[model samples]
Target: MTDPKSSRLLDNRWDDAKAAGLSESQLLLYRSNLLGSDKRITNYGGGNTSAKVIEKDPLTGQDVEVLWVKGSGGDVGSIKIDGFATLYQDKLEGLKNIYRGLEFEDEMVGYLPFCTFNLNPRAASIDTPLHAYVPYKHVDHMHPDAIIAIAASKNSKELTKQIYGDEIGWLPWKRPGFELGLWLSKFAKENPTAKGVVLESHGLFTWADTAKDCYLLTLEIINKAIAWFETETEGKAIFGGAVTQSADADKRKAVAAALMPVIRGFIGKSESKVGHFDDQPAVLEFVNSADLRALAALGTSCPDHFLRTKIRPLVLDYDPARDNLDEVLATLEASITAYRAGYAEYYERCKHDNSPAIRDPNAVVYLVPGVGMITFARDKATARISGEFYVNAINVMRGASTVSTYVGLPEQEAFDIEYWLLEEAKLQRMPKPKSLAGRIAFVTGGAGGIGKATAERLIGEGAVVVLADIDEAALKTTEADFAKRYGADVVRGVKLNVTDEAQVLASYIETSVQYGGLDILVSNAGIASSAPIEETTLATWDKNISILATGYFLVSREAFRLFRRQKLGGNVVFVASKNGLAASPNAAAYCTAKAAEIHLARCLALEGAEAGIRVNTVNPDAVLRGSKIWSGEWREQRAASSHLQVDELEEHYRKRSMLKLNVFPEDIAEAIYFLASDASSKSTGNIINVDAGNAVSFPR
Candidate 1:
């Protein structure tokens, strides 16, 4: 039964556990195992699962019982009842707002012993407080891999709306523990009929009068998600695909046996082993896919899978045409190092002083060249479930390709999600102080509203921002205002000509040394010189190229070198105008340079992606900054020469954009931040328009 059940057996186990009359040990094991079934279901034990038991309370006036919940390191699948700490139900409910004086990192430790008298051998699930707050008999907290896959995607809430369509109530991603539970209790109170509440990016919660209903509801909800995804993406299988070779039953069994121990180690089961790669055509095809390792390059379906899948799959790079163990070993070692480095970087990016950093991968999948896929989990159950999620994610992405290219979340957004406090709280430990924190990002043309606003947002997110412009007086005046707003370390003022390569390079070095490293480079320095095609001259072209094209390259090159040497992925933003995309009348040279810089940014985006470095360009249409070319006097002079009024000049340009709102530097910065963060790991070589829908007219 388990063999055929594979990943689906989890649903059955939950049902069977309840009917069989669970032992104290069996009950704890059942809850833990269920929680471990999905990485998203419980990450580093981010979620909590509990069972009610009858017991005597000495101080109680009437007879009452308690609940035993999973404690620290007592992974759900293997957890014993002894691993569960008991807390009196009434006392647990009475202890409200116990988190006031406790540090978030230590909150788990401080609260565990206070709520339970049995002295749990492990730390209580952080959400124990929330579980106690609710009136339900059974409560389960799971990140629910399927749920997060939908949540972390672009406009996930809207996607959920399209999928579930009022089937579930969705909440924004928030810091978990006390607040998360409180939020849920309040929400549950408001919506009395919700079957389950979907916590965006966090996970899902379900409850019922009986454990069977709750367990079935878990499947029903996830299956609803599965069905919704299927209906919306009709005929697109998340995992099923074509295979290049026929399955050899003998070879399959041998492979499964060889992988059993490793698989069991991962999912925490011994008899569990690899199964069904033989039954699935896509699994076979994926193993045979060209550059299977490269295909595995996609990040996990969800972040917690990073704990199991170890961030990516091991590419079988094995030569089906010939045997190559040395090459395989070399590739394996390289993969190990790369994975470790990524973990290290994540640790440094969001680590907290009190928590120990994640030092090793908890799970991995092997992608052999000719052979099919093999995944490792603490037990066979986890491995099988994770494999399904991976296979499904790959298929969905590939199928989505048929409809249109898959565009990932913007980089900066990915960074924000990956490093978000709520998500970070799910982990047992976090990274130390951010290595990139306090670093200053100097953006030229900072007096421009977009540049200024980008600086402001980055400062607020914890990075120091330096505003630089050729307008020395404006720089100094703006510097004073920002310094007052963000404090001395968070804001800086620099007056340098980005057009001067020496000055740009000097400033880059000085800024790096001053802040320990340059975290962001916003090359917004440019001048626009408009001329009719007939009157265009070599001199006019040189001037535009000098500032917009050449200067941007020089500054970016210096920043890249510094970042590369430091081995930290720094972000770079280029401020090009929409003229780069569609030509406007009498602006040939300016448009050409802006277009060239735009192309340069694309090259950086692709080349810099692997190093964690990012580069993006913003093209705003009608930024009314005081450029000598776009100044009122200059416009009036040109309009008089053309026998047109000044108002006509403004109308002509304003009407060019669809929305007719003048584009500003702030608009550009919003897109720039999206490209700069880790949230956009899969996004690069993309251009975002800040022109109030002007790009729609570009003949797409």
Candidate 2:
């Protein structure tokens, strides 16, 4: 449905007022963020930017030139000033004396630290030399989709000449290092009148005296490629014009929902993996196309895309016309086995003597015809970012294949980059994964204080969370706050009245669509009512059971269903109450419902035992600080029942407990965290009383 001839794609967001007072390094940061703001300009963490600024040396107190460039593994869009690496310009120029030619170019990375300015420890990246040796005041190296579309074409050199005549130059594909840095310098020197050069199968490099001028030139050149492609491919068929019809939105999601957990289980056999689903227009257009298999086989040409998405994707054996979902599921295991074997074969064939052991053989990208793409990674953000990179590759394929035969990076070269010693060292340097790192959880009363606290704990241990609550306003606020504190990828929110069974199922489906599926379910949604046995009506009793007892059943049933489908087992934690065990006077309805919740969890624990599904309960007492149950009449009723003022409830509860301490939301959250993690994997079907050592509430 895209209009090919509609040309305006990127906007220059530079503001003169914004740039007027910034220092040179600050200006460079501003420019880098501006160019990185759009995917059309660069994929996340793909490009490097730099500026040459004169600063007083900390030791000599004399003005000296320094190269300020993005540090290793930094993303331009979200980068702060601290994310840049500063190196002495003179020291960088002096590294040439020790250069040992192309064979030892990799040795150049080790020497980068020797050139550090002011002892800045932000480690220089491999791209640092590419920016440092440019011989211009400001430089930009971006991998825009349109420009890469041209760079990735079969006749890229000829296309470059036709597109810009002598204004831009082109270079053959070379692994980025000191040798390539010299190549760029020679090209810039040889073509004194040229503004920039495109590295074959790589990206574009542009430079200017001022940061704004470099920013403008980069945008202008990419804009030209965008316009040219719009005209050249205007009437041409894209990806051979979509051989398979795309399933409607609902059907596509349903298929994705069904396949994700199965794929996740296989991929996480060794280490757990999180999933991301993308059915964007571009993704659908490519996946449903006639040329998908052939093109995907060739793999991604750019190094960034190649590294993030692996050599190639596994194409699921699915045809929407037949709607044979069952058949697809049946063959999924065999397909994954074959993909892993092929990946191992690739590593064996292409690895050097010292190459790292073959990494996880499973493919990172999964392509399903008539459905969409699914990506699995060690965590949610990486999975989502990996998918974004593939989309960039898809765009490149669409543009290049329409105009010229699209070409992928050669397999051997890709292997060399994948297993490069420098990259391996970086991988080894990564911190250990958190306890719950690839797990996903759903909190039913996610907007309430305890629900929010539980979510914070889970996310701290690296679990992505989906929050479902009936309070629309509170849900939105909590979602925004969590998204800000954590990341947008780490949390999501949806409205749900847990008592509604259909609504419960729909919410679970939405969670699958949002984050593949669940591994943990926190059943914390409830209500408390206190009425004398004589005055308690049938309505009050039903309401307490509906929200506290039956609602738990609805959510747990759906969780078990998903757990069976994933075959990855599951974790379920119920927030029961101290009242569930000891008879509390004048609160028969509330106490009975809480008791039912405890027994229900025990029943589920027994039923799910064979499948590795663990169910447990946390019993909290008088959590008055942030309990929604205590926000209504329940607070006054409890205080009156205890013969204390509303303000004196905390003290009363503390004095009444054997430990002489009051319980809080955070206390319950810690217990839930323990149950949700593997630390207590062998201790389910039990209760953790977070009630300040109340003997009556203790499990006998």
Candidate 3:
């Protein structure tokens, strides 16, 4: 589900008028979207939906049956028509001739490519057979929390029969593959009246002859489970009833802010990992509960949750009542050390001879009593989604333990799925991460043209950006635009006045909490002024010094603190000006302040060298287009000083350059990108002149 953000009861969002003109295949897509729209129905990338539609064969004009199912690694909630894998139903049925038995079920996946109906490139998921063997024309295989709660209970078969009666049958747990498909098919055939079946320690499956019916039936079954749990567990305690009080909202955030970077530092010694923190009601209740450790240790039941969240979360030793944050900080490395050892032990005990060499032993999810849950992964989305999966697991545990003894999938079975050869192959097949993947950035003056361009460049390479701007309105607009283009998880906006020391401190704290810590800081925020030396007022001089000089120091100081805290090293690129290197006519205040900015970068470079922090400068001149500072009197003043009209500023700068080319915000952004990235790792305290070649303003 795309996070409705508000909890709404499960209501059918299907508009009959909307689905009226759609073809059978289109209707199937429509049905899948509605089911996926609510996380109450299924998770982000969990679950599968299918439809057996009649289509004219691409080879012949004859109508044939084609099974359209959700492709591997695709999310049903956001899936499109092209996201499905289509195969001839007849060809799938013929697979029985080659089926050796349960032992050869893994081989069935290899033959699936030969069954592709139209040469569609989307790979079919392993759940393909489970959907194919079902008699119904439309099928939904969902891992809804409400339904999985029942499925994961110790007496799941009994509970399934009790809650759903004869309409829903129960089946023994079998690893998902060709064999599980046969089990579902045989059960459906015997219980002809059954509309669905509950797979123990797995999830729910509902089917129908038509698309809408199947969609509604899936919702009906899940809602019934939800409603039953509510009634049965009405006055009962959950997770042994929250043993500790939840820290108030603000306190929880402060605690999270303090802990995330420290934990990130310890865990991120190898490859970098981004972090996500959640202290929502559900998470707080789980972490503060009496059974938090025991239930967490048991792990998750559903295969999708297990795979996304790992075998179990690392529950820290924290006392909410004592408020032992410093203690937690001091012992963080030890806690992580213990967790790694535990993960290694689990891997050794559960691993098969052919199992992939013990994957990263670090735990993905971390549970703190008062602070809430912190999850880390290769990028922001994975970290956030890992938290979501654990939330799903928490909901399952809450409901199951209240109504029945909650049971987790066995250790052996969880290991087999986690280290499955096909799963490892899928991991190996993932595309190489972008250049800036797993890096976090803080961009100042982020609402300005150069700031926006630099942010876009960095984000394109996969860095998560925190956009800080003095203008709140422009900040909102740029943040919204970036969020729409790059996804809401990758970019955030903060209103910051670099001159305000308190605001800068608060903004850095916000950044640390929002994203564990920043690896890059593009200090680009500024204003421009033009005046004769005698006419330049104390106010003008102070304004220039406060923003251009003082602002850089404040932001850089905070960045240094966070960099040292994370122990991840750092990169700082100051967006100074050509005026800083060479004197400009009449703009003494601006030129002097810009010079201070350059010298500051050099000083910081010397201090940070031992810690591996790199500080560099990018000097840009006469960037007329899309420059906020240039849009003001600065443009008219510079043009007047150059003996040209305001409109001729671009041409004047272009012709004045040694290369006779126009300097632009994008050109400056390119220089900043290089310095911010590892491309300039070896060259610190250096300067890049992006002024289309100005011999006079060149750095000596």
Candidate 4:
């Protein structure tokens, strides 16, 4: 019986698409989105879909049959019509005769592009031929976790026959290319009544005359297999939950926090390599599973996954209570060496004369029993994607094991896919990431204008940021908004009042426990006060000093403490003001507090220098708009002191600068980013004046 949940999802999507009056291409797009929206069905770029349509050739103005398939590098969920590469069916079919018996690489590189019907240059998916060869008008292909579990099992063909009956054809594992397409075409002709085809150790394919029919058929097969696995695994314990006692949890956090920097440093020694460590709930669960060592030792479930996660995950032995950090590091270094040696051996076992050069020997997924999983790559996005895929694969393995003995693609097959020339080309085609690809940053007052702007800038450069603010409502809103703009893993929010020493310490502890450690700290929290020297009350002066000066000291102290414990160098950038550099009339409280904060940074820089921590200050002038400090009675007071109206005060400040440029919060953020990154590595105890050429506030 089809699973009710799966049936409901497919029916709702189909009905909605039809109600929207979608055309065939639009319906296909809608169907692809439905499949891609669920990671259980397909990951970021792991699937393909297509529809057959007749369109007029631009050059000849003649109607011709064209197959529109999902193009490379486009996620199915957000794909548009242009994301489908149009190929003439007749031209694509003609390639069968021209490139018969060609190697996979030669066929893909030489004859594939010639089949395109349009001048638009997007490359078609490698499985485009399989879609075209099917007789049906619509075709869907995806690596659904359920379907993969069954397909990658020990006796895949027999299990597929048991679940899908004779209506499903089983194709042996073959590299996706001309040969696989030809084999599929032959199978379809022989078994004309087959509803779908299962490619062993790869994925599933379903085709029908309509898009809805094809999509529903795909879902039905996957759901049926899942139901069978569930029934078979009833009352069986496949894996145990993590040991979550308070002491165990504390030990896990401590080990993870201490070991992450060492692992990062080891991997980052090479210029081309970088590493990111994550212990999210799913990773922790997987690492703590009772059979992780045995299960992870098996090869990857499918060939496509091998391109992202290597053939086998590197599993490390770590006992939080028994193993000291130094001992763990030594063992980890030895394990990494063994992993590299094993990879080299596997390459030698599989490589032929035509094989591509071996890829870097770094393992994408690292499994630590108590500490959790650490994913590594040259950049943050790849590392995250790898971790996500491994989590899905772990679930697949558990389900498969409960039903029968779990098996995966053989080592040789995995090697072929990992070193494929097309995969290498895809990597080469991607643009280089920013310098801070895997770094973590913590920004105080992040719900405010300047702090939010700085956090956004850091995220743009590929840093994972934690935003701390005292305003609970605004903090939650900003966190949700940022998660929507970027991925949820990119930015997090913490409710913190920097003036409260307890809150400040708790925020840093949470940062270390969650993300392993912090790399950059932007101390941007402060309050502004304006009063003549004689009129300023003691309370007013203390309030300004407590937040502006004392707050900076508290956050910096915690950050430095964490850096010393982890033994990794870090960066701290203080957001001071131009008022601190040169006294502004009638703003004695704010000016004096900022001046104290600036000196605090300098003193910290002196002490932190020996530990390789760099500290600096950025002084911005008159960022009037979107600034909380420039609002309320302070705005009126500043305008009155400048002899201008409130609205005209902004323009007056802009024109006062020698550059005549309006300083925005983003300008200050850029200055802070420079000091926080390696661009200003050699310089510390320094100040950058971002006042749009304010001569009086210039650094001496």
Count of backbone collisions in candidate 2: 0
Worst 10 residues of 4 by lDDT: 5-14
Q: What TM-score would candidate 2 get against the native?
A: 0.98
Clashes of each: 29, 0, 0, 0
Task: Summarize candidate 3's per-residue lDDT along 389-473 as a digit string, tens digits.
Answer: 9999999999999998999999999999999998999999999988889899999999898999999999999999999999999
TM-score of each: 0.45, 0.98, 0.98, 0.90
Worst 10 residues of 2 by lDDT: 1-10
- Every candidate's lDDT: 0.60, 0.92, 0.90, 0.80
Q: Write the per-residue lDDT of candidate 1 for residues 517-598, one digit (tens) a residue.
A: 4557888876766567889899888888888888888888887776665454668888787778887677788888998988
Candidate numbers sorted by TM-score from highest down? 2, 3, 4, 1
For model 4, the local distance difference test gives 0.80
RMSD of each: 24.0, 1.9, 2.3, 3.4
Q: What are the per-residue Cα lDDT tens digits for candidate 2 across 1-700?
A: 1333455657668999999999999999999999999999999999999999999999999999999999999999999999999999999989989998888899999999999999998999998888888889999999999999999999999999999888889999998888888888888888988889999999899999999999988988888898889889988999998888889999998899999988888778688888999999999999999899999999999999999999999999789999999999999999999999999899988999989988999999999999999999999999999999999999999999999999999999999999999999999999999999999999999999799899999999999999999999999999999999898999999899999998998898888877878899999997988879999999999999999999999999999999998888999999999999988999999999999999999999999999999999999998888778789899999888888899998899899889998888888999999999999999779999999988877797
Clashing residue pairs in candidate 4, if any?
Answer: none
- Choose the strongest candidate by lDDT: 2
Which of the two candidates, 2 or 3, achieves a greater lDDT against the reference? 2
Q: How would you encode candidate 4's per-residue C-alpha lDDT over 139-160 as one tens digit per residue?
A: 8888887888887888889989
